[model samples]
Target: MPDGDRYPLAHRLYPYARSADQDRDAGGPAHHPVIVVGGGPVGLALALDLGLRGTPTLVLDDAEGIGEGSRALCFSKRTLEIADRLGCGAPMVEKGVKWQVGKVFHDTDLLYEFDLLPEAGHKAPAFVNLPQPDAERFLVERIRTAISDGAPIEIRGRNRVTALETSQPARLQVETPDGPYALTADYVVACDGARSPVRKMLDLDFEGRVFEDNFLIADVRMKAEFPTERWFWFAPHFKSGDSALLHKQPDDVWRIDFQLGWDIDRKAELSEDRVRARVDAMLGEGVDYDLVWTSIYTFQCRRMRKFRHGPVLFAGDAAHQVSPFGARGANSGIQDADNLGWKLDLVVRGAAPDSLLDTYAEEREAAADENILASTRSTDFITPKSKASRMFRDATLALAARHPFARAMVNSGRLSMPSIYDSYLSMPDALPDGPPATRPGAPCPDAPLGDGFLLEKLGSKFTLLAIGCAAPETGLAVVACEPTPELTARYLGAAPSALYLIRPDQHVAARWPMADAATVAAAHSHACGATT
Candidate 1:
């Protein structure tokens, strides 16, 4: 048993290196094509995506290793799919806790429990819970392996960005342990956390609402047989009239969050004695447990107006932030990397115009708005700022126990999901009366293909899938899938033959019943943000 800050978690420390010589041979001062600031999951994943696309990338971070404590412990299925595309999903899925059922309680009475995935046959689960440090370590291992395989991805830890210049080629003043150096990149991506120095240098502000209530989060290590599910309580016996959340994690560690009101002393509340008492009251005095880590935080649902600023682009918490209720912060940021990776790769290789980058901002900003709205509503329901809001929330919880309609109104954090890009880069077309899940602007549904999965065949390049029909010969990769009942139900509903043009990120660009080379090419061009 250790204190809050000194929990035993092993992380490999990456060594710092001078990247000046590597870039000098490429061109002028602009040596690296892309420089990713912050070696967190988002930055590392973005670098891996670009590296897989045959682009050289440089990643710089101030810290030597993955962060301590289980900061973010939930991973959505969409995020796992993105990780799977990047070659790190299997490890996470194998090591994480898979859960789809969640229970909501109203003061010692179980109100309702819901299952996220009612039907089976999907490739990925609804969600998985793993420590954030574990996920980051897995990404780092993948990056090192890719580098060993000559993917042109380099990571430099303890390299802090002191200042940034956002000109034609972005320049960063990096401070390392050895000395200070200047590195210039053709394009820079800021995956730095919420207090982003890059965003500050660009004079961008995060605008949104900040809730007054504070929360105490503790990770306790104990041998308890708690079921692997999410248990959320609104007004419980232990912490009467307050909201609490319980989640099971790996290694028999349980994460508990208690809602603390606005006017509380920070030091007194975080004391070891106070935390022990709270745990005793919740888990009972006889249960034995050790406090692994503890922290206090306030919720803020905020985002930058635009994610892209000139040659520097923002992702992850740097671009947007939300409360932990919905687990939207890291999930949406991973999706941002997934969306920007291919577009940036095409732009760097001169295959697509710079306008393609604007679509990333447009689509991710819309996603940010959606996440903020959901997180705000969840926070309001749980905390209830005003008396009337509390009344409405309690009433809904009471009615939810009896009426099925009220169950849908229970907002115990609408979990994160992939955003459907309806208005941004997807080409407008009428779906020919089929399953709407694989429509234009949506993620390509995963199906079992031969011995592998459908997503395994689509990413890293544009793919043209011809289902139950002959495909027109084109420059894009073609996947001709035979019509099976599972494939038809997920991909082709009522059509005998169909054509889908999928982007490098596995999102459906456009689909047609029958398409020629010209039509597919036009749709591909439109997906790349070409006006004509």
Candidate 2:
């Protein structure tokens, strides 16, 4: 009963689905060249990528094994692309449920339904909802294989990195059941989570506002079946205080979250019976379910003011924690790895300088701040204080459901739109002063190519697009990819005036009617870490 549309898919689904650690490494001096503090998805993904790049990494986790808990199930297309690059996407694609349409309902009343796969693209919409543990397992297996293939990766379970100190490089003092041992690395990445000891030990400032409201989350197997077609979101479930969310997981499991207002007895309120009763109240009579897991937690939208400190860097929840409204936590964390992976590869290969690491803070910070604003706005909409805000929230969704453009806006907020980066290092060629064109620092959109491959295939590397005009013989070596026909028609009001340069991450690096020495130099300088 692993959710809907079950298929006998690939076996490698959720790479980190390692069996619980039954064997305890009798407290030994297990040291690697580079040690990853957290063994969560981010840390694991980092280890996998590092291994692929011929770097030996040590992953240490306090947990006995991978997590089975259903937290952060949604994976964006960008995330899938990263997984595919790691050779782990096939298994994930086979096992996970592809959600094409996301329906929003207000107390059994259908408000709006957005088809995530808007047009010709991957069959799996813009995202897939796979159990977090499954994903972790898939990755863990991959790491093990890489290790067998001479990857210097050692996964030490039940080992916690208690303290961190930097000398010439950086050092981690991990506490095991036996004793504390010292390990050093060229760099240390703190993906340990929100309550990261690394961030705390370093005394790095996590700055942001904390909302007073607490949310009660429960993963349960429902006795009463509901349509898997929609995501039920209620502002105030049957009252002005109680709120609930209904989402589907991989198995025949539903994850329900209730915003149980500002006041409640923390100790007594989270009891089993209390949770069961609350679920019954929301769905109304005859609703029965077996609670698989239950937890109460409060969150604040905050990010480490600085992602990098000396040789230490932060990823995932350790770097930022956004309200779960947009499913930003795990997705953004994975992207952080994506951002860092290639850059680190380049730096290690001497293709890029250490300064390239600075872009991690710059690009990711922008994304984090955007997530904060979006999550805060969503929370404000649902947990409205003033009458006007409540009314606006109601009217906005109501109106948008009827209007196409407005409908897009509503979906954008809910679907967690791909983040854009506006770094000080962005080039002028990418963002020409002329009317709005697909520019750098913007999430690259797909356009049609002749061979049925989307423009993105060419975008895996830095590209220069020529839409209408003849291709210019600029001395810079870049992928001169084609533009989307729709874009050419809409933006140019006709065939596009050729030459648009794109980045390796698929962002538009430079757009010109024709490529020239000035634009080529500008694009190269920007992409090669010269602008920074």
Candidate 3:
């Protein structure tokens, strides 16, 4: 609490809000468990999950409504599991296009196509494209309904946080429709975008390199369409030095990005006629289309050194940003909210020490670094503007034109696989010797539960799956997730054996051998922070 938070107006409006003198004047009902700024998918999802768990939260966004435009449409299965937990997955999934194979093409010549279903056993596959605005609206409506239902959360639109001071307890001075008012909360999480005002205001260094070349993106609604099963990558087209990517979006629309070498004036080069000419060169002669929206942007792959400064923590783009290759932008941000929600839940409930909150930086920073590296690799390989690098990329795609598997490898490299946290402060060195089961540190494989439902049926909480045995009493009272032997056998093609433990975040926590009471208890204790 600060002097501003104790003002008469502040006291009158937020009487229940905590203040420096309020603790002395009798600490009121915990002033909003956490204050989250930025109501994008990351911030809103975080608030929704926290609210569902009965924690009070305040979310502020400057915008009048949910975000619009065609940005970040790829949703990973892990993200789906998170949305399922928050109870908002089905609607968003229904609005997107699910693909099995994403093909790469070099100037109308097929190079490689990847089947995500085979690589990760994800029946739905990797990376789907949809209008971001539609997804955001669905989430916003769900959040509003929860507020109407009396969830302990408040969302203030047209409100911007101007100054944030992170002293003993985090405090933010925000500008609302009414006036400037101060808010105090136990913790603050910033989910603001790349040019984060909070990051700049705090003077934290966003250390990374920005690429010099700029790219032009155009969204077009076309009557004639390409194959829905593929994503096109054009290299050295027309004059042996042009690069571009065309991805299909929902509603018969397409998003095309052209790497128009670094030096040309964007105004002169990116005109509608110039863009239409480029599309014609790749599609060959006559291609009818109407441009919906277009913009030009440079790529920057930078990350903040620290995601947390005292009580303030950064999630999503506020924490880091990467080149938009692999659709890492929003997908990674959603993962950030998922990772932080559980840790914040634990800390607020006093189930885990405040030190557990530090793991947020360690885990998400590693994920962010992976995004930067993958994006940089894709940019260098695909849009190599340098003479020498261009020659190399040309030679590489030419070779892939002959070999199919070689092309799949390159495309898979760009899909941006989920980074595992084997080295985190949490998790053990190795899975304890187990009878035969998926162990901790492994992504949980989807199996079948009884009554036609599947293993995917139990993801909202930490799950204890007993293969051929009943739930062992570990004293933690974890949900007993029974496995259907017939379904497990059909999927894994092996007889079901041993036990499987799923974390609250839907990751495999540990596997035990033959339902040994002691080992099961130990694994459960560790997963729940009892032993640690």
Candidate 4:
């Protein structure tokens, strides 16, 4: 027998302030360039990106602060890089549990351990374990700083959108603590969670396969010497469930997940005694711990057919969702913000046509598919239904303990990585012998330069990365770097010098061994979705 949790975590870091728009009665809805619905990590990230880019943006969150519990725990490296670009990565990285090593176990036996980021010379780690609320808080903090520095960003917390119309300038009927008022924006982005109110309001089809099993996410705080590493179990020795996950976070918080099968007592399973019993069993008899927050989830791998719906758009879980297996949930959503921010900024500023926004749908939808497939595969591996399949999985897990070849077959969870967009906006590579990592349509990998790194130089706009050569004048930001060993391996490959046309989102649009002014201009035009 065990006792229930004695500790409860505090939520809500941001305060709700009434907006003047809530009091407007007469004139049509107040108009802004862009408005984001949910103030979770994705929405805050999008608003922050747009704000730093000198675009006026507003965020309307149903809640005043970050959610309770550590909803999303794993933030990926690419996500950290994106956060760096948004000017808020330092605090998060500083405050997170930094680790790249993960170990898998079969029953009481250690299968194998793997390193996510084995190489050096990167700014961010493979992944960081931070509470989702803390991540969102950092974004909000950056938004406030940007505001003080004259970036037009405002967050009206508790200003929920009751209804919305997707006209040319989309109109939204917002409900605040004060009262209800209407407002409009040139573009509306919905970053609401999986059961998105915006998706419901529009009556859009959000389709995907839902797994039957349930998972209990328990965040516990205990004073113990647990290494900051990921530990996963298949048929855990504790005899709690079929599968389990244990991860560490900052502030002595540790997250545990037990996969409860489809057939279980919902009420009994969630009972305080039952939950505590499971926790006690996992930790063994004599560990003192307090449960901070606990949640049960029946995760699904699903997404909307299209992320863009005319004047309105969808990002984050509002657009797609996947099992928590791969830290793909928040990581992918932040990516949505990164993908959409610059494109939306271009369209709003008339620098790029509205059609450019369609590429956001195209690119992010592809990413969603990749995430869904990975999540589905992970779920299937973790909970094999058929007896023969289970046998195979068990054999594979056992063999992975010793054999290197069998380790590849073991799928604890395919971790999240940056999606290489086969985007329509990209111009094909002219040099056949270029580094594949820096090839056209791939997100630029970070490298060492002077005292700083390569990504720090990219900023958030179109730039020309000239290596061992003079950059052609395309009227864009250009950085000339002498080809060091790291640069040569990452960007040059067999070629001695190269010119890369980088998009505003830091994806390589095109790469050439050398380019003249005319060639550079043509590549820029094609990269911007401008066809002659």
- Compared with the true structure, model 3 gives a TM-score of 0.85
Please provide, for model 1 over 98-137, each residue's C-alpha lDDT reduced to its tens digit, 9 standing for 90 to 100: 9999999888888899898776656788899998888898
lDDT of 4 by residue, 1-532 (tens): 1212322223455567766676667877689999999989999999999988888999888887776678888999999999999899998899889999999999999888989998888898889999887887788788888999999998887888999898887889988777788888999999988889999999996789988899888888898786889999999999888899999988887999999999877878877788889999999889988877777889889999999999899999999999999899999999999999998998899988888889899999999999999998988899887899889998998888889999898888899988888878777878677888878889998888999999999889989999989987668999898998888888999998999988878889998998998988888877776856
All candidates in order of lDDT, best leading:
4, 1, 2, 3
| Pairs in clash, predicted candidate 4 | none
Which lDDT values do the candidates have, in the order given? 0.87, 0.68, 0.68, 0.88
- 369: Cα error in model 2, Å: 0.6
lDDT (C-alpha) at residue 62 in model 1: 92
Off by over 4 Å in 2: 1-33, 149-152, 223-225, 235-241, 386-413, 430-437, 446-504, 511-522
TM-score per prediction, in order, is 0.96, 0.81, 0.85, 0.96
Candidate ranking under TM-score, highest first, comes to 4, 1, 3, 2
